[model samples]
Target: MSRPDPVFPFFLDHPARVTSDRLELLTALVNGPRFDPMFRGDLLVVPPDHPVYRWQCRVGGCERPGQHHVELCFQQDREWAEARASGGNQAEFLEAATRRQHAGWSRFPA
Candidate 1:
């Protein structure tokens, strides 16, 4: 039996672009707003079809399928409860995720 190529197209499609250092930043924010103090313990889920879809383009080929990702929204929280109770859309509490690189292109420039 032959081993498969180490770098598969799918795996390369959305390689972990966020740097290890920035991972602390991204995960802290994404995991939950309480994880960080910027958004009042709110959680924003970027829809699978959010406009920032290109951020996940690993090869810059823009060939990945849409089903790969999903948008998440702040589903539960004290503020969310209050706002929803008052009939308000909490769009302002959401943010798009940014990609970062620790080693950067210099380490693997194409």
Candidate 2:
């Protein structure tokens, strides 16, 4: 018989591969989608009906109602950090971090 996927059939069926920042964002949105109606590009359209919008896949192809499909959110933040590391402060760092966190969820891998 053929072998199954290495990471499958474990305690967790399918674990998400989002970065630290993305996970933070998702946690915030999942907890309270009303906080940011238009986060990044994906709409936090969490109606009063369904509340638990867990991310199923990492390809962002699934028709899920949330932005949990994305896996990475580092490129933008890295760029921003590099460009402003000279004298940027906490606000700049936060802005870049936020942008990257959401951008990773919306932007497709290229």
Candidate 3:
């Protein structure tokens, strides 16, 4: 008896079968209770305040997304650092920081 080829697997031989299996698996995953409702649709539009997917800056009126691990966006973070160095606190910074318009690329289409 001969062994099957490792490079060209039996599943790869049938494209339709593989596609169907993937669709079925995706459907089951989407239907699971643990799945987030925001991702169930064809277009994914996550809310800024989503607990697990928060992307926007937390400062009021700021339109940019947060940096990697911090809640403030890049510009806001820099501004905060400067203010803090000059003896300003978070509350004063939040009240004094200028509001920024959204970046061209960050805007979503209607």
Candidate 4:
């Protein structure tokens, strides 16, 4: 059977516009926010229709000042608590959790 398409869609949508390295950079651009400190601890939940969304990032160190990408807010967040409990069902979830209780994202303010 054919494998599923990759998460990076440039190749399928704009094949003539970019090279492989461009794809790599685009992929990084899309996911890089997942590592910045301010975003790591926040929960990401979208409704079924995905409209009327709420986007929150903690206020702290970031290249774009006033926009935080690293934070310590997760320790008190209820979602964090529940996720940790649920994550325990997965193998070695504690060992795999991020320092700020996030999932594998960096904790540094840089």
Best by TM-score: 3
lDDT of 2 by residue, 59-109 (tens): 223322233332223443344457577777645554444331333343333
The TM-score measured for candidate 4 stands at: 0.18
lDDT by residue (1-110, candidate 1, tens digit) is: 99997655555655675355367977767677454342334564332233554223332222222223422222223344566687776564222222223223222222
Could you tell me every candidate's TM-score relative to the true structure?
Answer: 0.17, 0.20, 0.64, 0.18
In model 3, which range of ten residues has the least summed lDDT?
101-110
Give me the displacement of residue 41 in model 1, in angstroms. Answer: 31
- How many backbone clashes does every candidate have? 7, 0, 0, 6
Please provide, for model 4 over 41-89, each residue's C-alpha lDDT reduced to its tens digit, 9 standing for 90 to 100.
4564332121233122232221111112222244423334566677553
- The TM-score between candidate 3 and the true structure equals 0.64
After superposition of all CA atoms, the RMSD between model 1 and the true structure is 20.9
Error of 2 at 36 (Å): 20
lDDT over C-alpha atoms for residue 80 of model 1: 47
Whole-model lDDT values for every prediction? 0.40, 0.43, 0.82, 0.40
- Candidate 2 residue pairs that clash: none
RMSD of 3: 5.2
The CA lDDT at 97 in model 3 is: 84
lDDT of 1 at 66: 22
Model 1 scores worst on lDDT over the 10 consecutive residues at 58-67
Sort order, TM-score high to low:
3, 2, 4, 1
